[model samples]
Target: MSCHNPAAKIDIPKEAKKIVLAGNPNVGKSVFFNYLTGLYVDVSNFPGTTIDISSGKLNKDVVMDTPGVYGVSSFNDEEKVARDIILYADIILNVVDAVHLERDLFLTQQIIDMGKPVVVALNMMDDVQRNGLKIDIELLSKKLGVEIIPTTAIKNEGLDKIKDALYRAKPGNRIEEVKEIIDKIINKVDTESEALLLAEEDENIIDRHNIKDFNGQREYIYKLRRYRVDEIVDSTVFEVNQNASFKTKLSRMMLKPLTGIPILFVTLYIMYQAIGVFMAQTVVGITEEVIMGKYYYNFIMNILGSLLKDSSLIGQLLIGEFGLITMVPIYILGLLLPLVVGFYFFLSILEDSGYLPRIAALVDRALTSLGLNGRAIIPMILGFGCVTMATITTRLLGSKREKFIATMLLGLAIPCSAQLGVIMGLIAPLGLKALIIYCLTIFIVFVLTGTLLNKLMPGESSDLLIDIPPLRLPRLSNVLKKTYVKSIMFLKEATPLFIIGGLLITVLQYTGLLDSIASGLSPFTVGFLKLPPEVSQAFIMGIVRRDFGAAGLNDLASQGLLSGPQLITSLVAITLFVPCIAAIMVIFKERSWQESVLIYVGSFIISFLTAGILAQIIM
Candidate 1:
């Protein structure tokens, strides 16, 4: 149940106590977690975009996020993790959905039964009021025997009160007896027994000699929770009309077969044109060429080049054609800059608007047939933006099997916006038929490969359990804030990889390793794919960034070396090759080393084979 493995406990930091934000799922726990931790929250959206926990620093103190659970005794994986955090957390923030106060109170009562010091955040108070619900906060606070603060997180309200409450928080005398009883029950059990009890909610416990105790303690706790939740709902919650609203209708419309697929196609079309064409081409062209190429590039190359000229190796590594100085600005500014920024903007709106879940539902059936759950679409959709980010998201997939399949498909089939853009730009000069072939080939590979892997891989499939938030226009301020945070995170993570990649390439070229490698790969290059031997180094550059190889192809296209058929083959190969190094690093982070290596090799072979086949057919 605990996502973190149990190792010998580290000593708590001398300066600060670790406070954990705990709550039921979809109760705005993450939003409160974000607010409490401010800019320090580590935003990890797993592959399915399902249950993720984040940690943030609150002053000198640390705030941990536990996945939402229904109750401490619940069978769900998240529930077990919640109970552990409750037991271990120095302080707890029990977040409750104000609109569904009764349902939220079930988990609250579980935490209360454990006797941890907790403050109740009555989140979504604005929504509660809009539905004609009124809660006597003071009375409810007294009943729960904890401080209750009303918060409308989307509006950024009530955060100050939470901070103030944290400062003043102390263990309540009211729950002392209950806490002592639970602690006694817990401490008496062995680690294995404890885990079993937590996961199975087993009421019976046997000692070392097999003496069983059925003292009615666990049942009594269960009865108490039922009574408390019923009492709270009758007293606090007031749902008006109680029927599906307009937003609910919209949600249904977005998932229905008749309408959903059309909407999805339209959305993808807009996304492609918006990010791939306008951002990557129009905006990036101006930034990279007109401004950077005209001024910054000349200044850096002239100054740095002159200084290091005495040592050719140092000069080339620093400022030559393959140098970090030469490649960083071009790769970052030309290829990544526009697409990354644009994607952040796009992602902000989708996440905030809460339409992603509906889209998942719509595409669920199709994806499932390929041996992937419908929720896997989230990362696949994200792959169009950047494979690195998408690969990191694979953490959301419930099973390792699913993660492996998704990662492999992503590396082999999904082209990031930069590569897609360049392909579209290059192939369009030929005709739309070239574009169709390009797309159809990739889709066929994605499906056939995923299906085969699904059959070959051994593991249980993850049945998708996803939250479908009410459809609403995203708040502009929230969108901007999320976009800004993600953009900063991307730049920080990627810049170093870009610089190092460039420097490595420069070194390889200077040492003659590049030529040797190219010569070795020439058979596959010239004979099968019918590409020039120099294109081997291009493939090497692509390991650093997919778009870097794409830019390499653009250079070949400029020199008129590749014919129409060869151009398409090269494009397909580069696109399907292992996603850039950033993506590979994320694969390592999300999956095991064995799984990541499998994906890397599988993608490498698949890309080359597909390219070779395409060359034969087209030529």
Candidate 2:
């Protein structure tokens, strides 16, 4: 647990020690991390939900919440990060679901072998009890050479004990004894398990950087584990009850191909309607009209404008009809706020019910042909919320090829909630056929591009490894807390960009750059695509931020400048065009400047070419 990296700061307070909440996905690690840190990290029931690390200060100490990984191997990028952190942590608050102890224990064994400071957070104990499942925590603790604290993170139960345990615990040293115990446990494992175990512990088998040798060292660890399994199992503990219940049968049915596909469609339909339609439409409508439209906008414009009336520049910049102030209230209330809350609520419910992995499994074959695995579905689904986050989540994909394709698809095809919200609002009056074409156009592009990318990218598709947890009723407290956190995240991430984009447009309009660019691009807009020159201005706005661009288009469309074909063409072009500034920035951060530029230029070329073609066809 100690490190000689002098630059690395480990501020261990005299009173409290840092506790890291680590576990596989959907095990309430974030809820536990949030409970300890007193900061809301979105805790969804879905696996691969948290791609990037979210750390917060916990009572004078820091608590880091790592993305859930099934193993501590370098097979995937997220797992590698998790492995590195576990290797360096002072203590691992390993959270496992009580109901799915066996499956959860798979990762616990990997952690125990890594020989780091360890504590078992047996989370979701209530679920265990409800299902008539019993775990001998003491026995399990002894078997794994770690402390076990049964918890219900959703209810905030056992958190004090978790805190107390960390406070009292000393920094961990590599457990030679536990490592030997893992050796014995490996003997009982099958060839597959042994291969994985050895590969993880092997010093020479590099999963990230190019390795001199591709030969796996998994067999060596398998031998070591086989030699020690009996002692570990004997010292540690487990109890098995095989009496099948209704939940068990239901869980099986969910994974089966026959019944699962229909269920998945129904679930997706409900999710789209609930999050995309109801939340984006009804809730956003209420907030935008009742709050921002009626109160905030009038007050800001009138009061601020009157105060700065004599200073024409200041008045126009701060409180003009099209200033950031005028846009801020609407942006937050109409697009960002409602979408975050509604999407998170729906996401939390799906996550809690353990349907996410099943969805992945159902879609895995399709994803594989698209150059991704079932796991890629997580980021692809999240792309609807924010491509920036989804871009970061390319780390979860097993291969570089898969990651590249996923990132590209997300950047090119996925429309964030803000974009969707604004688009829905603008096209609402245009009828369902228009909306359907808009939807179908983007989806077809996603699939076609994904299929082509798969053929072009050189690599075997990754095998889908998914864990399906028992379906449980989502706890209301957890749902609300998660939704609240995501809302805050959305606002925090989007607001500054929205304001800056607004300011940039205002400046462009004032400085005549907008007119020059619009004029330059007018041929493409009016002549090529048969749209007004102003639509090209909207495309410029879209590059800065998608919703801002959509709002600008909304202005033109409302003025009757666009016909049906032109509106549809503009929508398609804007959606397929370069990602918003935020997504582009994320791509730059996660990948590189070159990749980001490729995304931007490639998207622009493809979008415009397609738009021109589509305009001709429609015309």
- TM-scores, all candidates, are 0.66, 0.66
Which pairs of residues collide in model 1? 46-393, 46-396, 47-393, 47-396
Top candidate on lDDT is: 1
lDDT of 1 by residue, 327-446 (tens): 687767666767777877887788889888888878888877677787898999888777888888878886778888888988889988667767766776777788788888988899
lDDT of each residue in 278-390, candidate 2, tens digit only? 77678877888767876887777677766776346555566654566777767776656787677777777777778788788778988887888889989987887888888
In model 1, what lDDT does residue 405 have?
Answer: 86
Each candidate structure's count of clashing pairs: 4, 12
Model 2 stretches with alpha carbons more than 4 Å out? 1-250, 309-311
